[model samples]
Target: MATIRCCTCGSPKENGKDKKNRIEMRKKTKGKTPRRISLRASLRASVRDLLHMKSKPAFVNVSFKTDSSRHRFIQEEIAKYGKGNITSRIFTYSELCEATKNFALQNLIGEGGFGRVYKGYIHDLHQVVAVKQLDRNGFQGNREFLVEVLMLSLLHHPNLVNLVGYCAEGQQRLLVYEYMANGSLEDHLLDLPPQKTALDWTIRMKIAEGAARGLEYLHETANPPVIYRDFKASNILLDENFQPKLSDFGLAKLGPTGDQTHVLTRVMGTYGYCAPEYAATGHLTVKSDVYSFGVVLLEIITGRRVLDMTRLSEEQNLIRWAQPLFRDKSRFHLMADPKLEGKYPTKALYQALAVAAMFLPICL
Candidate 1:
């Protein structure tokens, strides 16, 4: 065979045989050599492209000057119903049944005019949540459920109870909410004995403020404005931190539009908390909520039920007893809960009382 030189070493070797062997070796080496890809270089290229690309325009431009304006802007944004936003979810009755152990009585938390609330865990979020399962016999049917879903999907505030999601399967309708560890304000204020001392004056003030913020958000902020028909202590839930959150939307309605003073509707609400004008004339307005808030404020102050027939002869009805006290600053001290042991600041308490008292005339 003819002589040949090695490609690397350049050494003279056998002719045809060595040349053939070297070529084969070269092919094998090329096959074994790994191709290098620089991830850093590719990333740099991607960043450059992103920096050069033109950004898409925003869906909407919003401007606001006052708290009311900010609220209106948020409401308008929510009404847009942008794509990829999850409004609500549908879950099979079997899934919910499994979650609540077939709606067992032991899992029940509380029962309301609308339906029963139960404690449940969602595997997807790995979090504990309260599930309100609407009873088929409830006065509010699918219409109320849909209204609640739409309102909750658009409304979001720290003091307002959040609507995590909803489920509609067959005859079953369910609403999921973040679990309130401390339960409702009514449970601590009215159900629990005075000896419990769980809700002190400070906590009561904080709760009142938080609940007010929630109402203000709904009234001044929500798009088209919303009137919470059922605004009572039982519907205000307390979290582990004692922060109050407004809930229960089965009786809620959209507030009045245009320059009309009030929207006339069928009278619906708890006895003691309903506004006088709403009860008598079936006309509702934002002032109706203010009236209910005043009643809640009274409950926080005097440690009394709105309508307690079992009390002492003169103090049977709390509103009637407190109305006169509200007018005379000299009797303001008597309006506070005696269990407070005179710990609350008189000035702040009086201010809150004044705010609540102003609602009486407006509501009437």
Candidate 2:
């Protein structure tokens, strides 16, 4: 992996001691409630209901900063990354074409609304990677391409997909990522071939835990918190060891900060995973991601797609189908995937169902 200097956008400005802190300091000298609780102002308290605090994140110092245009911001941040010891490499279009066998169909591994992704081997790095070639005709595709590039480039985490490099030669925009051998969680979790072995309860829990940590890092640790607008199974890729890493940052948004409560943006995300509040109003918050995480958690436990038209009309929606099961604790076990054949621990299943149920939105 090429070295990307992952740091906050701007220099941190210290807050001056104000009247409130002065008074609090007096009280503290007198040995009462401390004046200033924390410089970050109990950041977790606001989203505690959704996030449920457990542990502190690895400390990295970076404060929130924004530029006029997202494109300019991406360019600036990436430029900063370039000053580091080993900067992100800029791959030529022809180099990537050579790697992917001239974009042949046989190497294709994944496709989405953005465009097609193919498995390729880069000779320079002598490493296998996934090359995502963006749709040339779509203007939005270009913006998304840049956004994904900026996000993966700036943000580095164990649970987030690594961006090996990118090819922006001419009009060709493509992203090179570390090849995920196990494909997506959706590949093995939801629909499985008759011959494939089902994912055990332990692995399912581990995947959920890793995914949740990735989301939590975005929400709590990023310089300016990031709202992962799109959180679903297909977006969570698994590695050779079944370790889950969150992917696809095109839909991510810089979350609200200071006094701001949420970000306002057009509704976008996989249908079944969109938070009801986000769908009803464009107000996007870290909780928007938490809600989507809940949906995925349910999917992990049940091994069902968020939406399926082929299913019975009532059960087509996974959340709604889970309602009665949540209401009746005795029936919670029924929500477990039948393919498991009752191998999961009973206590763990109940706790998982409860936590998943808690993640769901109140009205939805």
Candidate 3:
């Protein structure tokens, strides 16, 4: 009998004898587990979430753009199969309109470069949900829409946002997700209303740790290893208990593997959070995300915006303001968020700062 490896369990046995064992293992570990799929030769550009703008689109006439025929091929495949084939619930445009009260302005909870997000109630599921309505002319297009559907449909983890359903009818494109009560880390850390409670040292660290674990899952557990091209505080959503979940798969890229150095692609991300090397060259690697994660970690420690122009020129950039202090252990206290009111642990502060330094680019 020939020896064969079980794809799901990675156990080896005589091909005919363990066939039943393989089926048993798969049945026992159903939806909660991930399927082990092999990596493709190259990831399609349409699979990436490229931020488009009027003056400066995320991707231009770059070399990485997929061939026109290939782009159309994917579009046709998605159109023919539709959302019903993807295993994610499919919602008609009218059904979503009803769920979100006809998408009234009052239901709108958040808006960004891509589109407006609305809070909705789904009676059938007896659950509250977040509905993302993509702008036809905004940064996200049909490619971005399909990419998100496919990515979220395949990837599942505790720290990643759950895709409940999606709407694709006529010209409208929308995504439905499990409602995040606390909103994003950006809301808790950067600007807060007078009565809004501030995140303490412990809560901030917990959120950071959860966000890091989510990235680790994508980078390590996922067979192809996803690179979160746009890793920032705003993308990290929090539930009722302040647990963090990474959202917005629009800019995510599949990491290079098997001795490959990096994948060359267009530089696409927020200005301040982009890694310096990635910005200089279109070469993207797992470290590109690590660099952005560091910036977010720094923001959590200091309670400062990544790039605030209102501050003095020297202090406007958070990284620039904290670099000198990172060298002196005594001044590490200065890096703590003023809102923290000096209540954070001294030793923990040092350890967090040390982690931030590891992510930042070193002077050569």
lDDT computed for candidate 3: 0.76
RMSD of each: 26.3, 11.7, 10.0
- Looking at candidate 1, what is the lDDT of residue 69? 43
Better of 1 and 3 by TM-score: 3
TM-score of each: 0.73, 0.77, 0.80
lDDT of 3 by residue, 1-364 (tens): 0111111112232466577787798778754564544222112222332223232212233122455543334434444434333567888788888899999999999999899999999989999999999987799766567667766776788899999988866667799999999999999999777798889988998888888888877776665677778899999999999999999987776777567777788888899999999999998888888888889988999999989998999999998888788777788899899889998878678777777787886321
Candidate 1: misplaced stretches above 4 Å?
1-86, 361-364
TM-score of 2: 0.77
Which parts of model 3 are misplaced by more than 4 Å?
1-76, 79-85, 362-364
State the weakest 10-residue window (summed lDDT) of model 3.
1-10
**What TM value does model 1 have?**
0.73
Instruction: Give the deviation of candidate 1 from the true structure as CA RMSD.
Output: 26.3
Better of 1 and 3 by lDDT: 3
lDDT of 3 at 111: 98
Rank the models by lDDT, top first.
3, 2, 1
Q: Where does candidate 3 clash, by residue pair?
A: 49-250
